[model samples]
Target chain A: MKMKCRQFFEEFGVTRMIAVGFFLAIAIAVPVLHLNTLTLYSQALTRMAMNGVLVLTMVPIMVCGAGMNFALPIGIICGLIGGLISMNMNLQGFTGFFASILFSLPFSLVMGYLYGLLMNRVKGSEMMIATYVGFAVISAMCIVWLFVPIDNLVLRMQMGRGLRKDVVLTDFWAGILDDLCPVTIGGLTIPLGTFLFLFLMCFLVYLYMHSKTGIMMRAAGQNPGLAAANGINVDRMRIWGITLSTVLGAIGILVYAQSYGFMQFYESPKMMSFSAVAAVLLGGASNKRASIFNVIFGVMVFQGILTLSMPVANVLLPESNISDIVRMIISNGIILYALGKGSGKK
Target chain B: MKTIKQFFSENLVVIFFALLCLGAYLIAGQAPYVVVSDLINRVMRNSILVLALIIPIMAGMGLNFGIVVGAMSAQAAIILITHWRMTGMAGIVVALLVCTVISVICGYLLGMLFNKTRGQEMITGMIAGYFGNGIYLLIFLVLFGTVIPFWDEELSIRSGIGIKDTLKMIDGMKGAMDNVWKLQLSQVLIAVFVLYTLYMAYCIVKRGRENRSAVKISVIKWLIWGAALAAVLLIPSVSAVVTRCKIPMITLFFVILVSVLCQFITSTKLGQDFRSVGMDIGIAEASGINVNRIRILATIFSTVIASWGQLAFLQNMGTFSTYTAQQNVGTFSIAALLVGGASIDKATVRQAFIGVVLFQLLFLLAPSAGTKIFNDTQVGEYFRTVISNGVIAVALVLHALNKNRKKAAQADSI
Candidate 1:
C-alpha cells in the first residue's frame, strides 16, 4: 500500500498534484466562505468550456516538438482580424461566429506556416523566440489596430480612428454557444453547446493524433533524427503541427470572445498564451507530450480554480485584486515547475 | 572602401539603429539640447541595467530575463527604507545594502533554477520572473498587513490590507545621487578627455619601459579619440548644447565605474571560465570548469548589479508605480543591449553603453516622430513597443540562423 501510494505520487507529477490540491482547497473554501456554490460551479463550467480550445492548442505543438506555443497571439491576432471583418459585414449569431472562423482559417494557415518555418530555423530555442515573436506581432498589431479600416461604428472608438479597446459583441454572437442549450439542474447551469463544441474539437484532435500523419508528426517530434532516417519529413510535420495549433488558437479566441461578450484587443492577448500553457501543463501534460485528456482535465481544474478563487478571495480580502495575484502565482508557478522538470524524460 | 564596407557589414545592427535614431530625431524636430539632455538622463538611468545583462550572457544563459527579480528586490528594499523613514545618502546606502542581500538570495535561487532548466534558461527565467512577481505581490498585497503586521497609512491601502499602487519616495531619497556634484556637460567632457589622456600617457610610459610595439597603436587610438572630442567642442552649436546640459557627476561616475568593472571582470580567470562555458558546455566541463557553478556565479553577479542598477534608476525617477515598475526592466534592458549589437552568446560593456544611448534616443524621439508623422501620440508609443520587441525578435532569429549555418557548415565538413 505504501509503495503504491509513492508510485502514484511519482506518476501524478508535482505540478498536477499541487494544482489538484489548490483546486480542492478552493472548492472547500467556496461553501465555507458563504459564496454561491451553484453559481460558482456554473461559471467554472462556462470558463472551462470557453478556454478549453485554447488549452487544447498546446497539444499538437508539444507533440510535434515546437515546445509551448508561446506565440499564441499570432493565431489570436488572425482570429481578431477575421472577427473584425465579420462584424464589419454585420454578420450575427452562429453565422457570424462561423464566418469569423472561416475568415481566420486562411490567415492562421499562412501565418502558422511562416511561423513554423521560423521555428524550424531556431530548432532548440523555439519557445523564447516564439515569445518575442508573439510580443512583436502584438505590438505591431497595436499600430495595425489603429488603422484597420473597419467601418463598424460599434467596434471602432467613438472619438478616434482606431478600434475600441473592448469591442462589444452583444448585438453579434455574445453567449451564442453558452446559451445554445444551457441545462440547469439544482440551480447549477451547464453551457452544453460550448461543452459540445469543445468536445468536438477535442475529438477531432484525438482522431488526427491517431491518424498516420499525426503518428508521423509525433514520431518526428519524439526523435527528429530517427524520423528523418525513416523518411518522415520532420520539418514538414512540425509545420503541420504548428499550423494546426494556430488554427485551434484562432478558433479558441473566437469562442473566448463570444462567451466573454467582448473581443479584447492590443495588450490583453499578450499573457493569454501563458495561462493556456499553464492549464495544459496543470492537466498532466509534460514539455514534450500532451493529450486530449490533458486538455479537458487541465482547463476544468485551471479555470475552476480561477472562477472559484475570485469570489472567495474577494470575500476573504474585501476590495483587492488578490485573485489576479493568485492567478499569476498559480499559472506561472505551474509553468516554472514544468520547465524545471527538464523536458519530462523520466 | 573595402575596410569601410567590412565595418558596415560587421556593425550592421548598430549602424541600422544609428540611422533609425537619426531619422527619428530629424522627423521629431526637437532642439539638439533637449534631445542631448534627455539622452544623457536616460543613458545614465538605464545603462547599468543593460550592463548588468553582460555577465549572464557571457556565461551562456542568453538574456537573463529574471533580472526582474533583482529589480523587485531593489523595490522591496526601497519600500522598507521608506517605511523606516531613512533619508539622504544614508538612506540610499541602507537601501543598497538591503537590496544587495535580498538580490543575492534571489539570484542564488534563480541560478539553481537555471541549472535545472539548462538549455531553456531564457524562457524559464521569463516564467520564473512572473512567478517571482506573483510572490512579491502576495507579500505586499496579502501577507504584509495581515501576517507580517506592517502598517502605514501612506504605504498601505485604505483597507489597510495591502500596499497602494504607487508609492512616493521621501524627498531626501529622491535625487540622492544626481544632486550631488553636478557638472556642466562640456566640463564633464573636458574632464573625461583629460583623464583619458592621463591614462593613455601612463599606458604608453609603461609600454615604453617594456619596449612593447603596442604603444604606438595605443597612441594612435588616443589621438583619434582626442580629435573626436576636440571636433565636438570646436563645433559652436554642439558646444552650446553641451554647455547648456548639466551632468549628474555622481550618477555618471557610477555608470563609468560599472563599465570599467565589467571590462576588468572579463579579463579575470572566472571570466574565461564564463566564456568557455558559454561557448561549449561539454568542452568547458571537460576542461575542469564547474559549468553549473560558474553559471550560478554569473547569475548572482548579474542579479546584484541589476539590483544596484534599479536603485540608481528609481532614485533618479523619484516616484514609481509600486506593482508595475519592475515589469518592463528586463524587456527594455534586453532590447537596448541587443540594439547595441550584442548577441545571445556575446556582449560587451561598449555595446551595453552604445545600445543604451541608441535605444533611449529612439525611445525619446519615437513618440514625437509618431505625433509629427501620424498625428497620433499613441501611434508613436506603439511604434516604440514594436521597435523594442521587434528588434529582440529579429536579433533572436538572426542569431538562430547564424547558428544553423554554423552547424550546417560543421556537418558538411564532417
Candidate 2:
C-alpha cells in the first residue's frame, strides 16, 4: 500500500498537487471572502469549455508519439480564415457557426497534411520544428492578412487594405453555443450547449480510439518498431493523427471565437498553444499517452486556476494583478516540470 | 567527374543561397555600398552570437536553443547596471561579469536537466528557454520594484514595478567597444592577409613535423583559400565595395581571437572528450570519458559566451528593447548557422562567419527586393522570416532523413 501510494504520488506530480491545493483553497475562500461563488464557478465552467477542446486536440497526436501539437496555430489560423470568410459572407446565428466549421474543413485538411508531411520528415525533432513551422506560418499569414483584399468592410481596416487586429463578433455568432441552453442553478450557470458540444467531441474521440485504426495508431505510438515489423503503416497513421488533431483544433478555435465574441488575428493566436499544452500536461498526460479524462480534468484544473486566482488575488492583494503573475508562474512552471520529466523518463 | 558531382552534392544549399543573393541583388537594384555596408556592420554585430552556438554543436547537443536564457540573463544584468548609474566601459564590464556568473549557474542547471533528458535535448532546450523567460519576466516586471528594489525611476515602468520596454544606452555604455579602434578597409585587409599568411606558415610547420608529406597538401589548401579570398578583395568592384565599408577592427579582432581560442580548445584533452562524447555516448562511456561532465562544461561555455555576445550586441546598438531584444537570439543565430551549411552534428568558426555574412546580407536585401518585386516591403519582411525559419526546418528534416538513410544502409550491409 505504501509503495502504491508512493507510485501514485510519483505519477501525480508535486506541481499538480500544489495546483490542486491552490484550487481547493480558492474554492473555500471564494465563499469565505464574500465573493460570488456562483459567478466564479460559472466563469470557471465557461472557461473550461472554452479551453477544453484545444487541450483535447493533443490526445490524438500524443497517442501517435508526436508529443504535444505545437503546430496548433496552423489549425487555428485556418479556423480564423474560415470564420472570417464566413463572417464576410454574413452568415448568421447557428448557420454562421456551422458554416465557419465547414469552411475551415478544407483549410485544416490541407494545412494538417502538409504539416504532417513536414513532421514525418523531421520525426525526432518534431516539437522544435513544429514550433518554428507554426511561427513561420503565422508570420506569413501576417502578410497575407494584410494583402488578401477581403471585401467585408467590418473585417478590413478603414484604410481598406489590411485586416483589423480585432474583429467584433457581436453582430455575428457571439455566444451562439453558450447561450443555446444555459442552466442557472442560483448564479452557477451551466453552458449546456458548450458541455454538449464537448461531450460529443469526447464521445467521437473515444469511439475512434477503440477502433482498429485508432488501435493501430496507439500501437505505433507505444512501439513503432514493433508496429512497423507487424506491417502497420506508422507514418500514415501519424499523419492521420496530426490531421484529426488539427481539425479538432480548428473547431476548438471557432468555439473560442463564438464564446469570446472576438476574432483576433495576426499575432493574437501566437501564444495560444502554450496554455493548452500546459493544460493537457497538467491532466497527467505525457509525450506518449493521454486520455479523454486527462483532457477534461486538465482543462478544468488549468482554467480553474486562471479563473479563480484572479478574484482571490484581487481580494487578497488589491494593489496589483498578482493573479496574472501567478498564472504565468504556475502554467509555465508546470510545463517546465512536464518537459523535464518527459525527458528524464526517456 | 566524381569531384564535380561531390562538390555539387556537398554545396547544393550554399549554391542555392548564392543564387538567392544574386536574385535579391537584381531585384533590389540598390547601391552596392548600402548592401555591403549593412552586411559588414551586421556581420560584426551578430557573428559572436553565432560563434556562441559552435560549442554546443561540437558537443553534439544539436543546437543550443536555450541560449535565449543566457541572453535574458545578460539583459537583466544590463538593466541592473544601467539602473546603478554605471557608465562607459565600467558599466559594460560590470554587466558582463554579472551576466557570466548568472549564465553559468543557469547553464549548469540546464545542462544537468539536459543530461537527464538526453535525446530530447533540443525540444527541452526550446521549452526551457520559454520557461526561463517566464521567470525572467516575472523578476524584471514584478520583483524589480517589490522585492529587488530599483532606484532608477527612468528605467522602471510607470507602475514602478517593472522595467521599461525600451532602455536607452546613450547615457550608459553605447558603442564603447566598437568605437575603441576602427580601421580603414585597406589596413584591415592587409592585416588579415598578414595574419592568414603567418597562420598558414605555422600550420605548414606543424604538419611538416607530424607528417612530412602533409606539408605540401597543407600549403596547397592554404593557397586555394588565400586565392579565393584574394580574388574577392582584388576585383576592383568588390574592393570598392569592401573599402567603402569601414570595419570595426577591434571587435573583429575580439571575434577572431575567440574563434581561435575555440579552435585551440578543441585540440585540448577536454575538447577531445567533448568530441568523443558528442559522437557516441555509449562508446564514449566505454572509453572512460565522463560524458555528462563534458556536456555540462560545453553548455557552460556556450551559455557564458552567449551572454557576452548579447552584451556586445546591445553595446553596439547603444539601446535595447528590454523585453524583446533577447527573445530571438537563439532563433536567428541558429538559422544563420544552418544557412551557412552547418548541420546539427557539425559546425565550425568558418561556418559561423560565413553564415552571419550571408544570412544578414539576405536580411539586408530582402526588404528592398520584396518592395521591388511585390511592391510591398512587408512581403520582404515575411519572406525573410519564412526563409530563415524554412532553412532551419529544412536542415532539421534533411538531417533526420540522412540519419534514417544511414541506418537503413547499415541494415542493408548487415
Candidate 3:
C-alpha cells in the first residue's frame, strides 16, 4: 500500500496534484458561496472550448523538444493579420471565420519555418529566445498595425490613423461556432459547435502524432544523436514539429477570437501564451513532453478555475480585481513549479 | 583594417543603437540643452537598475529577469517607510535597510529556483517575476487592511481593503538624494576630471618610485585626458548646455559607488568563484568550489543592489504607480545592458554606462521623432519597444550562434 501511494504521487506529480486540488477547491467553493452553479458551469465550458485549441498548440512543439511555444504571439499575430484581411474583404459568418483561418495559414507556415530554423540554431536556449522573439514580433506589430493600410471602416480606429485595440466580430462571425448547436440541460448551456471544432483539431493533431513523420520527430526530440545516427534528419523533423505548432497556433487564435467576440490586438496576446503554457503544465505535461489529453484536461481545469474564481472572489472581496490576481498566481505558479521540476526528470 | 572589422563586429549592437539615437535626435530636432538635461535625469533614474543586472550575468545566470522580484521588495519597503511617514535621507536609509532584508530573502529563494531550473533559468526567472507579482498583489491588495490591520486615509482606497494604485511619496522623501548636493553638469565634469588627474598622478609617482619605465607613458596619458577635458570645457555651446544642466551629485555618487563596488567585487575571491563557475560549471565543481553557493551569493548581491537601485529610482520619480512600477524593471534593464554590448555570459561596468546613456537618449528622442516621421507619437513608442525587445532577441541569437560555432570548432579540434 505504501509503495502504491508513493508510485501514485510520483506518477501524478505534486504540481498536478496541487492543481487538481485547487480546481476541486474552487469547484466546491462555487456552490458553497451561493453562486449560480449552472451559470458558472456554462461559462467554464465556454471558456474551456474557447481556449482549448490554443492549449493544444503546445503538444507538437513539446514532443519535438522546442520547449514551450513562448513565441506563440508570432502565430497569434499571423492569425490577427489574417482575421483583419478577412474583415477587410467584408467577409462574414462561417465564411469569414474559415476565410480568416485559410488566410493565416501561409503566414504561419513561413514564419514557422523561419522560427524553426532559429530554434534549430538556438537548440538548448529555445524557450528564452522564443519569449523574446514573441515580444519583438508583438511590439513590431504595434508599429505595423499603425501602417497596415487596412481600410476596413469597422476595424480601423475611430478618429485616428491605426487599427482599433479591440475589433468586434459581432457583425462578422462572433459565436458562429459557439452558438451553432449549444445544448441545454437543467439550465446549463454547452457550446457544442466550439467543442466539436476543438475536438476536430485535437483529433487531427492526434492522428498526426501517430503518423510516421510524427514518430520520427518524437525520436529526434528524445535523442537527437541517436536519431541522426539512424539517418532520421533530426533538424528537419524539428522544423516540421515547429511549423505544425505554429500553424495550429494561427488556427487556435481565430477560434478564440470567434468565441470571445473580440480580436484583441497589440498587448492582449502577450499573456495568452503564458496562460496556455500554464494550462498544459497544469494538465500534467512537462517541459519536453505533452499530449492531447494534457491539452483537453489542462484547458478544462485552467479555464474552469478562471471562470469559477471570478464569481467566487467577487462575492468574497467585491470591487477588487482579486480574480485577476488569482489567475496570475495560479498560472505563473504552475509554470514555475513545472520549470523547477526540470524537464520532468528525477 | 582587420582590427577595424573586428571592432565593428564586436560592438555591432552598440554602434547600431548609437547611430539610431543620432538619427532619432536629428529627426526629433530637440534643443541640445533640453535633451541633455532630460538624458541626465533618465540616466540617473535607470542606470543603477541596469548596473544591478551585471553580477548575475557575470555569474553566468543570463539576464536576471528576477530583478523584478528585487524591485518589488524595494517597493514594499518604500511603501512601509512611507506609511511610517519617515522623511528625507533618513527615510531613504530606512527604506534601503528594509529593502536589503526583504530582497535577501527573495534573492535566496530566487537563487534556489534558478538552481532547480538550471539551463532554463532565464525563462524561469521571467515566469517567477509574474508569480512574484501575484504574491505581491495578494499582500498589498488583499491582506494589508483585512488581515494585517493597516489603515491610512491617503494611502488606502475608499473601500479600504487595499492600498491605492498610485502612491505619492511624502514631500520630504521626494528627491531626497537628488536635492542633497545638486550641481551644474559642467562643475561635476570638471571635478571628476580633476580627481581623475590626481589619481593618475598618484599612480605615476608610485610607479616612478618602483623604478617602472611605464611612468612616462602614464603621465602622457593623464595630460592628454586633462587636455581633452579642457578642450571640451572650452567649447562654447557645449559649456552652455553643460552649465545649464543640473547634475544630482548625490545620485551620481550613488551610481559611481555601485559601479566601483561591482568592479571591486569582480576582483574578490567570491567573484573569481563566480567567473570560474560561469566559465565552466563542471570544472568549477571539480575544483572544489561550492558552485551552487556562489550562484546563490551572486543572486543575493544582484537582488540587494537592485533593491537599492529601485529605492533610488522611486525617490527620484517622487510618485510611483504602486502596482505597476516594477513591471518593466527587468525588461528595460536587460535591454539597456544588451544595448551596451554585454552578452548573456559577459558584461562590464563600461558597457552598463554606455548602454544606459544610449538607451535613455533613444527613449527621449523616440516619441518626438515618431511624431515627426509618422505624425503619430504612438508609432515611435512602439518602435522603441520593438527595438528594445528586438535587440535582446538579436543578442540571444548571436550568443547562441557563437556558442554553436565554438562547440563545432572544439569538435573539429578533437
Candidate 4:
C-alpha cells in the first residue's frame, strides 16, 4: 500500500509541481510587481479563446492512441484558406462565417483522411513524423499560395503574389463573434459570442467523449491490437479520431483568425502547436488524456499567465519582451514534466 | 540487368539528389562563375558538423537528434577560449577540449535517457534535445558569465546575467582546420578525401585487426586510447602554430577519430553486446549481457559525440541562436542523415558524410537555384527551409512504406 501510494504520488506529483509552480510564480509575481491583473487576465482569456480550441482538438487523436496533434495547423491553415476564399467570394456576416467554415470542412476532412492514412502506415514514430510532415506540408502550401490566383486587387499585392503573409480580416469576419453580445461592466468585459462558441464546442466534445465511439477512441489509444480483437475497426476509429481533431482544429483557427482580425501567413500558424500544446498541458492535459474542463482551464490559465506576466515582468526587469522568457520556460518546463511523468519509461 | 536494377533501386535517392543538382545547374544556366569552389568550401566547413551525427546511427540509435548537447558543449568551450582571449591556434585547441568535456557529460546523460526508453529512441531524443535547449537557455540566458565564470567582461549580456548572443569564434580558432597549411590545394577538401581514404582503409584493416590474435586486443585498446589523448593535447598546440596560419586540424581529426573509434568499439565484443541489446533487450539480458550498462555506455557515447559535433558546428558558425540552435540542428541533421540513406534504426559513417554533403549541398544550392529558376528569392528561401524539412518527412514516409510492406508480406507468408 505504501509503495502503491508512493507510485501514485510520483505520478500525480509531476502534475502537482507544474500547478504549484504556475500558481506560485503568478502569486509572487502579482504582489511583487503590483501590475494590473485584469489587463493580463483579459489578454490570457483572449488567447485562450483563440488557442484553447486547438488544444481541445488534440483529444481525438490522442484518444485513438495516435500521438499528439502536431499537425493541428494543417486543418487551421485550411480554415484560413477557406476564410480567404469566402471573403473574396463576398460572403459576409453570419453567412460568411458559416460559408467560410463550410468551405474549409471538406478540405479538413480530406487532409485529415490523408494524414490518417499516413499515420496508419507509420505506426511508431508518429510524433516525429507528424512534426516533420506538418512542417513540410506547411512549407509546400506556402509555395502554392504564391500562385493561388485570387484576383482581387486588394488581396493580391501589386507585385502579384497570392497575398501578404498577413491578410487583414477586418472587412471580413474579425470581431464578429467577439462583438456578439459582448458585455462590459466596471472594466470587466466578456466576449460572449466567442465564449458561447467555445461553450458549445466544449459541451459537444464532452458529450462526444462520453459516447460509444468515444470509448472506442479510448480503446484505440490504449491498445490498437486489443481494440481490433474486440471487434473495433481500429483504423476506422483512428481515421474518425484524426478527422475530428482536424475539424475542431479548423474551427479553432477560424475563431482565432476572426478574433485577431487578420490571417498571418505560413509562420503565423506555425506556432499553433507550441501555444496550443502549452496551454493544454499548462491546464493539466497530459499527452494522452485531457478534458473539456482542462481545455477551458488550460486556455484560461495559460492565457492568464501569458497576459499577466508580461507587464509584470516589464515592471521588474524593465525589458519589453520579458514575457517571452517566462512563456518559453513555462511551456517547455510543462512539456518536460509531462514527458517525465507517468510510467517513467521513455 | 538485375544487378543494374538493384543498384538503381538501392541508390534511388542518391540518383535523385544527383539529378536534382544537375537540374539546378542546368536551370541556373551556363554560369561561368566557379560556384563549385564556394560550394566545396561550404562542404568542407560544415561537413564535419554533419559528420558528427554518424555514430548513434551506427549504433542503431537513430540520428543523433540529441546533437544540441554536443553543440552546447562546443559553445561552452568556445566561450571559455574567447574569455581567456587566447589568440591564434591555442584558442581552437582550448575550444575543442571544452567541447569534448561538455559533450561527454551531455552524451552520458542523453545516452542514459535513451537506454531507459529503448525502442522509442528518436522522439525521446527529439524531446530530450528540446529539453536540453531549455536547460541550455536557463544556464546561458540566466547563469553564464555572471555565475558560470568567464574571462572577458564584454561576453556577458548588459544585465550582467548570461552570455551575449553572438561572440566571434573565428578570431582565435574559427576556420582553423579549413585553413590547414593553405597548400593552394583546398586543403580542407583534399584532406577530406585523405580522411575518407584513411577511413576506408581503416574499415579494410578492421578485418585484419579482427584476425589478429585475441592477445592483441588490450594492447590495441591502450595504444589507441594513448594515441587519442596525445593527439588531443598535441593537436591544439600544433593548431597554435603560426607557420601557415593556426590550422585546427587536431580538432577536426579528433572528431574523425571519435567517429572511427565509436564504429570500432561497436564491432568489438562490447559493440556486439550493444547491437544485441538494441535488437532484443530481453534476449541480451538473458544472454548475460549487462543491458543496462551497455545501454548507459552507448547512450553516453552517442550524446557525447553529438555534443562534440554540435560544438564543432558552433565553433564554425561562431554565433548561436540561443534557444533555437540545438532544435534546428537536431531537425536538420536528422533529416540530412535520413536523406543520406540512414533508416530508422541504422546508419553508417559513409552515409552520415554523404548525407551531410548532399544535404548541405542542396541547402546551399536551393536558394541560388530557386532564384535562378523561379526569379522569386522568397521561393528559394522557403524552399531551402522547407526542403530540408521535407526530406525528413519523405524519408519517414519511405521508411514507413518499406516497413509496412515487409510486415504485410510476412503476414501473408505466415
Segments of candidate 1 deviating more than 4 angstroms:
A344-346, B208-228
Model 4 docking tier (incorrect/acceptable/medium/high): acceptable
Who is ahead in TM-score, 2 or 4?
Answer: 2
lDDT assessment of candidate 2: 0.85
What value does DockQ give for candidate 3? 0.79
Q: Candidate 3, residues A225-333: lDDT per residue as tens digits?
A: 8999999998899999999999999999999999999999988898789999999998878877899999999998888888888888888888778888888998999
The digit string of per-residue lDDT tens for model 4 on A33-130 reads: 76665555555556667776778887788778776777887888788778778877877788888888899898999999999998988876677688
Q: Whose DockQ is greatest here?
A: 3
Off by over 4 Å in 2: A27-40, A117-122, A160-162, A226-233, A311-327, B170-172, B198-244, B412-414
Candidate 4: residue A259 lDDT (0-100): 80
- The alpha-carbon deviation from the true structure for residue B267 of candidate 2, after best TM-score superposition, in angstroms, is 0.5
Clash pairs detected, candidate 3 = none
Summarize candidate 4's per-residue lDDT along B84-132 as a digit string, tens digits: 7775566666666777777778877877777655655666676666666
DockQ scores of all models, one per candidate: 0.78, 0.56, 0.79, 0.45
Candidate 4, superposed: residue stretches over 4 Å from native = A1-11, A158-160, A320-322, A340-346, B30-33, B144-153, B186-255, B318-323, B404-414
DockQ: which is higher, 1 or 2?
A: 1
TM-scores for all predictions: 0.97, 0.92, 0.98, 0.86
Worst 10 residues of 1 chain B by lDDT: B204-213
